[model samples]
Target: MLKTLLVQNYALIDTLEIDFHQGLNIITGETGAGKSIILGALGLILGNRAEATVLKEKSKPCVVEGTFNLAGYSLQDFFVDNDIEYADLTTIRRHINPAGKSRAFVNELPVTLSILKDLVSQIIDIHSQHQNLLLADGKFQLSVLDSFTDNLQQLASYRDSYQKYRSLTSELENIKEKASQAKADLDYLQFQLKQLNEAKLKSGEEIELESLQQQLSHAEEIKSNLQSAFTLLNADESSILIWLKEAVSSLSKISHFFNPAEELQARIESCRVELKDIAHEVEMQNERVLLDPAELEAVTQRLDMILSLQQKHRVSSVDELIEIREKLDVQVNEITNYDQVVSQKEAELEKITKLALKQAQEISDTRKAGSKKFEDSIKALLTQLGMPYADFKVNFEPLGELRPQGIDRVTFLFSANKQMPLNDLSKIASGGELSRLMLSLKSLMVKTKGLPTIILDEIDTGVSGEVADKVGNIISSMAKSMQVINITHLPQIACKGSHHFLVYKDQEKETTETRIRLLTSQERITEIAKMLSGEKISEAAITNAKHLLGSELN
Candidate 1:
């Protein structure tokens, strides 16, 4: 429960401190006496937006702090999860600087606004007239139904399965898309592979073919040159070798007459031997260099095929073509195996879908099982609030496919009169009906939600007389289990609080400021009388206020 609230430098409130107790706490003030301002300050602690405009003192920051007693709320896990120290008495504070920057703290440890909002929501619910509009929202309707069912664990399990199912479905879609694209390219891949294999290519075959083509193209010229060289050397008797042999014989005849001639003869003999070997090699080459058109054509055709393949494939060498062939082979193999992969993914998707559907069904069943009791309870409460013929129903529509909230779509159907057919809440319910319905639902929720505090700001907007009295009684009944702070202008409701507070403007100050004070017995009587007679406490109003307070005490 909220133990104390301290607000400073907020709109129209310089510094205000107040304490709240465990039962019904009533706050009554004139219109524009800053009751909403107090709630707005509390909103900052609840992580609502803040601005520099809210600062009454331009230089000082606006501060709103609430101390909560959290001993029996089972909120240790929340503190542990947010990594903050958990004390039985915990303080939550919000500071809004003059520049519009805001910061929040839990138990003096700095925290993000999201963390503060989450923790505060678990402890308190600030229900204003605005929340009555939420009755028509589908998600809110389903959430209310689920809260009544008390199926948090089942809901958590369903969410987990639903997330996995969505993920697997997405993965399966991607795999199918990949397989489709690969199959589209399969024919082209096979054609390229076939052409490469039929080429019978080798790593160095193109170089060898080019060299052979050069020799074959020049065969006739090579043969003619070799024949001429053979004739000059030793092909005829006047050749160099024959002339050298004659010189050697003359030198041998004069060897006994001159030693120089013998040396000259030996040198001419060596020249003759070298010329003979040269002539023999030239004859053999000339014979081997015969022009064959068939062989040349074959070599030329092979070289042309190699060059054509290189240009068609956009490669410079056979080695590059070889690499491409290997890569295509791997792609073809993977394409062949894609069907098996897709089948595996489909099976996995089916498995997860079954699990998700099962969990969703369990959730749906639980909701349906408890929905009758929920409707009966709401109808009973509505009767007490002066709608004796009110009809309420939880209408469930099963969805065709999965959603984040599961397969059930819940809508609250209502009829305020016997002849009025059940219709959606938004179309048929009046403001008074919405107020009473919201209060009834909240009364039901506090029992299951176990919140420590609930602040209702003018929930009696469209109610008065006996209905207002019943609303106060219901609120008082809610306070038996939790703390309820009601801000109202109705004297019937104001007289029912265990403690009463009066909010009024202090005109003594230079600037008008809103202030609150806990009313004593005489003050309560006077305040209730003032509320009854409006700024003039008449004798009849005073007697009536006393009787009302006396009856409440009974």
Candidate 2:
């Protein structure tokens, strides 16, 4: 519940602090008495956006702060989970500097506007004149029903299972897509491998074939050189052997004069014998040097095949060709076994999806039942709020198959009179009807959702006289279970509050200022009387205000 609210330099409100208590707290004043200003200031502290235009004279900034007591609530647990401080009391404050820069703080620790919005919404539900219209929204309708049924734990479980199922289904599709793509690539790879394999290519075969071709191209020149060497060794009619024999005899005759030549004669004969053997080997090689045309044709074909594979694959070396083949082989294996893996994933996803669908359907059934109860109770409330002849309906639009929210799209249907058919609430609900309906629903929601406070701004805007009184009573009944704050123009509604505040504007020093005062019992009578008769506080208005108070006491 809100313990106190403080506003500084906000709109006509230069400085104001209002303390609140249990039960209905009503604020009343004349039409332009800054009553809505109070609600707007409270809104700022509740994470509503603000502007610098609200700043007062001599004030560089506008500030709105609220303190709340989270008694018998799980708010502290939320703070703990979010790693925020859970003080004995929580103070939410907002400041807008002169330049229109805005900031918010929780427990004096600055936080982002989004964080303030998320946390404040959990604790306070500010249903202004327009907020009640959200009741007709489809998503909000589902949420209200779900909240009544306490389906958070179930919803969380179902969502987890649904997401897992979706992920697995996506994975299965991706695998199948990859398998199809890989199969096409595998076919192409196999064609390439067949071409390479049939070529019977050898590593370095290009370099070796080129070297052999050079020798084959010059075969005639090589044969001629070999013949010349053969002639020098033994091919001529007068060979070196004959000349060496004659020279050896001459050396033998001179050997008697030189002893060294006598030893040299034996070595010379050894040399002549080694030369004859070398000449014989050379003659044999000369015959082998001539190339065969058939053998050359085979070599040329092998070299051509290797060069073609290199050109097609764009590889300069045999090592690179081997590496590509290894990669293709692995890809082909994965493609060949793709069906088995995809089948397994599909079965897994199917099993989880069935389980999730079953759970979602169960939740949907429970939600429909809860919606019926909610509809009946709220209709009962509206009947008491002077719409006894109204009809409330919760209609379900059938879905052919199961979805995340089940097989139905829910809507709130309503008919203000018996002569009318039930229509979509958003299209048919009037502002006043929506206000009462929202209050009734919120009254129910507060008890179930454990929301700490409910603030209704201008709840009785269109209501008057007796209808306004009944609206007050209905809101007061809700206040018995939760703290309720109302901003009202109706005197009848203002008199029913357990606590009353009177807001007014005062002019002095050529400047207008707004002020808020907690009304004592006597002050309450004057304010209530003023609300009843406007500027004229006649005896009759005071007497009627007293009767209204007396009726409230009853």
Candidate 3:
């Protein structure tokens, strides 16, 4: 329940604070008496958008704050989830700066507007004139039925299953599309893989083959050079080895006469041995340097194959070609196993569909079972609200396709006269009838949903006399269970409140500001008297106001 509301620098309200009670708290004033201004300020704290024009003082910020006693509301989990401090007396505040920037806080901890909206929605419901048209909305109608049937958990389960079914179905479609595209390229991929496999590719094979080809291409020049060198060293008349041997013989003969001659003979003998070894190596190369055309052709063909594959694959190395082969192998394997994957996903989808259908059917059954009781309750409440001839029915139709809620579409049908045919509520009900109907629906929901506070902005609009009394009675009864704050001009409704507040404009030297005060008993008499007889209160009007308030208290 809301304990206090403080609004500062808001439109037409420089600074205003009001304390609220647990029961029906009535606010009454003439038209344009700043009642809407107060509601607008409350809206800001409940996460509504703020505008710079709402600032009464253009240079100052507008602030709206509400204190709520959350003892039995079971909101500890919500506070913990949002990482806010839990307090029995929770404070929700909103500030709109002069530049149109808005900020929200819960228990002094700053939070996002969406989080604040979600949290406040759970604790309070503000039903304005526009919300009464929600009776025409199919989603809201279904929600109301579901709420009455207590189908929240069942609806949640159905939605979960439906989501899974949709996800699996989407996956299956993607896989099938991929498989189709892969099949179109399957033949080309297979041919490419086979070509690579038959090539028998090897690392560094291209480099080695290129070197061998160069040597084989110049085989004649190489062999001729080797033969020329061999002849110069061993076969020629003035060969190096022959000259060295003759020198060594001359030096050896002089060795008996001088030591220097003996040293010269040993050096010449070493030169002759080295030259003889070079001649033998050259001879061996001249004999073995012949090139075979067949081997050369094979090496050339191998190098051509490697280069061709590299060009086709747009790569510079045999190693890169190998990478392409691995990637193709994976695609081929996936295609080969695609049927199995698709089958598994299809099976999963089918299972989830069955579960979703079961849950939806259960929800449908519960709604059908509870529909009669729900209809009876609304009809009975409408009767009490001056619609004794009203006929209410909850009509259900097959939705044909699965939905997040269920497979049923619900519509509320109404007839105000017994002889008239039942029509859609939106098409047939008048504003007064709609208000009463909305109130009755809200009254019913309070029993099931346990909303802590409900603020009705002129719910008694278009109603008067006994019907207004019934509306007041309904609101009064609803307050027994939760805090009910009603902003109205109807004296019948205003007189029924356990507490009465007067919202009126006060004119200062420069500006007019809206102010509200909890009226005393005598002040209530005057306010109700004003509501009954306008600005000029008559003696009879005062008596009637006293009689109305006295009777409503009983």
**Which model scores highest in TM-score?**
3
| lDDT (0 to 1) per candidate | 0.91, 0.80, 0.91
Q: What's every prediction's RMSD, in angstroms?
A: 7.6, 7.8, 4.5
Q: Supply candidate 3's per-residue lDDT for 83.
A: 96
TM-scores for the candidates? 0.74, 0.72, 0.85
Candidate 3 local lDDT, residue 520: 94
Question: How do the residues 32-85 of candidate 1 rate in per-residue lDDT, one tens digit apiece?
Answer: 999999999999999999999999988999999999999899999998988999
Error of model 1, residue 141, in angstroms: 1.2
Weakest 10 consecutive residues of candidate 1 by summed lDDT? 545-554
- Model 2 TM-score, 2 decimals: 0.72
Off by over 4 Å in 1: 57-59, 186-338, 507-512, 551-554
Q: How well is each residue in 48-166 modelled by candidate 3, as lDDT tens digits?
A: 98899999999999999999999999999999998999999999999999999999999999999999998998899898988899999999999988989899888888998999988
> Where is the poorest 10-residue window by lDDT in model 2?
545-554
> What TM-score does structure 3 among the candidates reach?
0.85
> Which stretches in model 3 have alpha-carbon errors above 4 Å?
50-62, 96-103, 202-215, 219-290, 506-512, 551-554
